[model samples]
Target: MSTKINELSVVDADKFTVSRTITIAAPIEKVWAAVTEAQHIARWFPEHATLSPLAVGTTGVFGWSDHGDFPVRIEELDPPHMIAYRWGNSNAAASTLESGETTVFRFTLETVDAGTQLTVVESGFDALRDPAASMDGNRGGWDFELDELVAYLEGSE
Candidate 1:
């Protein structure tokens, strides 16, 4: 649970996407809880998240600022291993259209030598009219978010 951003693994850029993986020094269950639980999510993710853990048709909002919320619809859930969702596209009270499109985000977790390996992938941006903005924005956002997550998991927050 180091705050050293440099230590995280950077997912190589794909055609129209960016991704990253970070190994948290915690067991898979602990890492999973930190990610899937609403209370734990708020500690690291956006300050406000409304989560529903149903196997199908579950949705929630991420982010706590005026920046607008991203609608998260669970597309796949595999216990302590994988959680895939469609992020962006809204039914939330308030939201935005930064190009009037949405992307698929997948969080894959696994147990490693000393902790859990979490990989985050967000794709489907070729449809975004503003390619530069979309890629840059998400990349920067992920970096900051991961930094915060590391701190939160380490109890530094």
Candidate 2:
């Protein structure tokens, strides 16, 4: 399967949400694993990720070498179909999920004729320190990050 990296995420200025929908040339199961599993996420997402066993309340840390750690929690889960994470947006070295303005990013997946169609909706940016800046930063972030996900799943990375 082949994949194209694109800036497909949409920033909603009024709703304080950023949404992106992309079709992956891989099975839902594979894409689900890449998104939900920490090892796979660390490959494409943060430099290091620590998540506990799958559960709605499980908390973890998504860490980056330059950006530090972001505390994350599983806000919702529905097997291979959906999972939502609430994470702090702080750039501090180590912070709790409650230490800063947090956002919920929900990933919803569907089986398509070609493969899987995944949509991520990140909301609650209105509560950030700088709502516009945070929204803009994450808009670009989701574009690059999800593109990596597509490439990783399609074996083009």
Candidate 3:
């Protein structure tokens, strides 16, 4: 199977949401695990990750060597179909979910002949001091991280 790159798009300039979609050559269950499970997430995205039970209101942290851990809360969860997290804003110091300076990351999955179509939409960039820059940074980030995820899953298979 061939690898695929994520398609990036801006939801709206004023809203400052970055959306990305990638098709992976793996089953929906495998893709869901990679996106939700800490062990699988650490292998592809964050340098380190700790996720609580996969349910609404559960919290977690995703850490990078350069940037410290960022608090994350499960805002929405729907089995192997969808999961959404409200995470700390990259521009501010790591903070709690109650803090207004947080962003939303929603991931939706659909089974396809290729395997799964994963669409990730991260919003709330407008809440940050520098919306444009943050949106641009995360656009590149999702591109790299999702591509890494595809590589990890395909390689292991």
RMSD of model 2 against the true structure: 2.0
Identify the leading candidate in terms of TM-score: 2
Q: Which has the higher TM-score value, candidate number 2 or candidate number 3?
A: 2
Give the per-residue lDDT digits (tens) of candidate 1, residues 105-154.
78899998857778898777765666556777778778888777767777
Write model 3 residue lDDT over 31-69, tens digit each, in one string.
999989999999998999999788899889999998778
lDDT of each: 0.72, 0.88, 0.85
Q: For residue 141, what is the lDDT in candidate 1?
A: 75
Sliding window of 10 residues with minimal summed lDDT for model 2: 91-100
Question: Candidate 2, residues 71-154: lDDT per residue as tens digits?
Answer: 899999998999999998853223567755788999999998879889999998887777788888898899999988988999
lDDT assessment of candidate 1: 0.72
User: Per-candidate TM vs. native?
Assistant: 0.83, 0.93, 0.92
Deviation of model 3 at 51, angstroms = 0.8
The top-ranked prediction according to lDDT is 2
Collision pairs in model 2: none
